[model samples]
Target: MAMRGVSHVEVFVRDKVSAVRHLRSSLGFAHVADCVEVDRSSALLRRGEVQVVATSGWATRAFIARNGEGVAGFAVTCDDVPAAEGAARALGAEVSALPRGRVTVTGIGDVAHTLLPADGHDPGAPPAGRRWVPRDGAWPAAGGAWALERVELRLPVALRERYPAFLSRVFGLERHPAQRSWLYSAPAGVTFALEEQRAPVPLEPPARAAAGSPPAASVTAYGLAFRALPAPVLR
Candidate 1:
């Protein structure tokens, strides 16, 4: 019925060391898996309940030369692909078929979303949101920085205002609790915030983006997982 919150976000980086360090030491992300190819490498990382898929290769080099380290794309999970696909299509989103029960839902500015069908939910699972419960070595004092809170995407001035409504209509997102903000809440409590930057920032697609691909922006920053971030020394 509702779109599962963000499944994962892709980040493109030039230096895997610095990026991995920032995400791990600074942001409390833990490495899950990695892949190394002839000229590029990537790894999957996690913090709290969110997942970050980072890729580095030739496209990453071009991306860094152009716009620096940023998010390449994001994915979401839903119960019904046909309904979600239909919603995306009705809004002029370019829906592309993918192998293995996947679909790419492209929004304005060519925002790429790989949609996948969700697994059956457990009936007795705890309500999913920020977990304030204490975990050893998980606090800033214990060498933790922060967990990802939300995602921010800066769009063109022309499209900034309309996109949220578009998201609301298609993704079934509601306004973030902050009231009067650009943030929208996806199911499972994940959120996406939008803004119109002073200058139109280029959409920095992942280094693997196809040539002449639609112009797309990058994910600039992930919000703190908690509402109020703990005071810590940001290196």
Candidate 2:
């Protein structure tokens, strides 16, 4: 089976409603779909080809409770979810079942994950009302608007080999030539680069000014960067 590269980035937040509003109003993202259950809420948002799955729940919130609100996991689209799950299991990923149509897996360092098959999975399409918005307009020569350029994974120093093997087994990601990392791609022009982190991890909320304060989005020791499209594609 030909598994696609990274299709979406999934974030675990405290409140899905507030996150949806904030992403739309402040971050220029538009909601594409909402999947809510008895205790969890997930909203899919898009800006250009970039998509995000923002979630909140007891299980999801555990990432926040332990690491604070930040990107908890990433998802790579696959030809078959069960096939991917089997591959992940072969690579030693901790696995679990999800309702409707999804599965969760964790590799070394317990990197959290969710597996969704390519068919019938509509986190919906890009929002209709808005155009794309670029942060700096420093679009790469690569013609595609909004491609995943890089992603950082804060893996435990010990579980180095297992993480890369897990990504390779599940997504067929090859090693990037320049960086000592894994790369996956799709026909739709999505690129995912995963780098193991080696910095001090911050568990508490980063320091803030005062009440009504918002901490800097750049505080986390680990992060992922997605390349943006040209101005025209955004529109």
Candidate 3:
């Protein structure tokens, strides 16, 4: 099985509209698509190779109620979904099959991992049950100016020794030779690090502010690092 790096991060928010607005206005992301179902609404945004799916509604309310607004899970592209799912199961990960042959597995805290087939399809497309409707008007050109550098995950110190090995075996990531930090990297240029915490920290939901106030900090479990690329030199 080949791990093709993170395809997208799914964040469960109380307000999808607010989340989408903040990302587009503050982070230079472009809203690409929207997915609406009976129980949920999702907005897909992209900036360079990074994709974010902000979702709200009944399906996400339970997660937000417990952990507050934060990342519910993330999807990674895999060459063989069955092989990857089997490997993760054998390594003690709780695995479940989803619609359209997708597989989801347990990860640290409330974070789950969804395995998506890397079949040369557009990675930013909405998942099953969500129809993709392109947004109107021109979107800001990414021009490969943004690259996801790292994903930081915080876990209880008790699992420090075993969790890194589990991630390596399941995702085929290389373990960085650091005794203090459990860092793993993939060939696709993204790093996943397990930071030790005394206990799981619940992310506080973004506070409701008066209209026209600055956006509040996004509630997220994954600490993301992004690099801005230099403008291309013109001859």
Q: For candidate 2, give the lDDT of residue 221.
A: 15
Residues forming the 10-long window of minimal summed lDDT in candidate 2? 126-135
Which lDDT values do the candidates have, in the order given? 0.59, 0.59, 0.70
How would the candidate models be sorted by TM-score, starting from the highest?
3, 1, 2
Q: Candidate 3: lDDT over CA atoms? A: 0.70
TM-score of each prediction: 0.65, 0.61, 0.72
Which regions of candidate 1 deviate over 4 angstroms? 37-40, 61-68, 121-148, 177-181, 198-235
Task: In angstroms, give how far residue 37 of model 1 lies from its true place.
Answer: 5.4
Best by lDDT: 3
Per-residue C-alpha lDDT of model 3 across residues 10-116, encoded as one tens digit per residue: 88877888888777765667898887888999988888878888889999876666555656777888778898788887877889898766788895455788887
Of 1 and 2, the candidate ranking higher by TM-score = 1
lDDT of 1 by residue, 1-235 (tens): 4677566777776667666766676445676556666677776666545567667888567544533456567777777777878888888888888765778877575346766677753311211222323224242221232334566555567776677876776677888778444565545566676754443244332234467775333222332233324566769
Candidate 1 colliding pairs: 59-207, 149-224, 149-225, 203-216, 203-217
Error of 1 at 24 (Å): 1.5
C-alpha lDDT (0 to 100) for residue 70 of candidate 3: 55
Choose the strongest candidate by TM-score.
Answer: 3
| Candidate 3 TM-score, true structure as reference | 0.72
Worst 10 residues of 3 by lDDT: 215-224
Model 2 segments beyond 4 Å from truth? 14-22, 32-41, 56-61, 65-68, 80-83, 96-103, 119-145, 186-224, 230-235
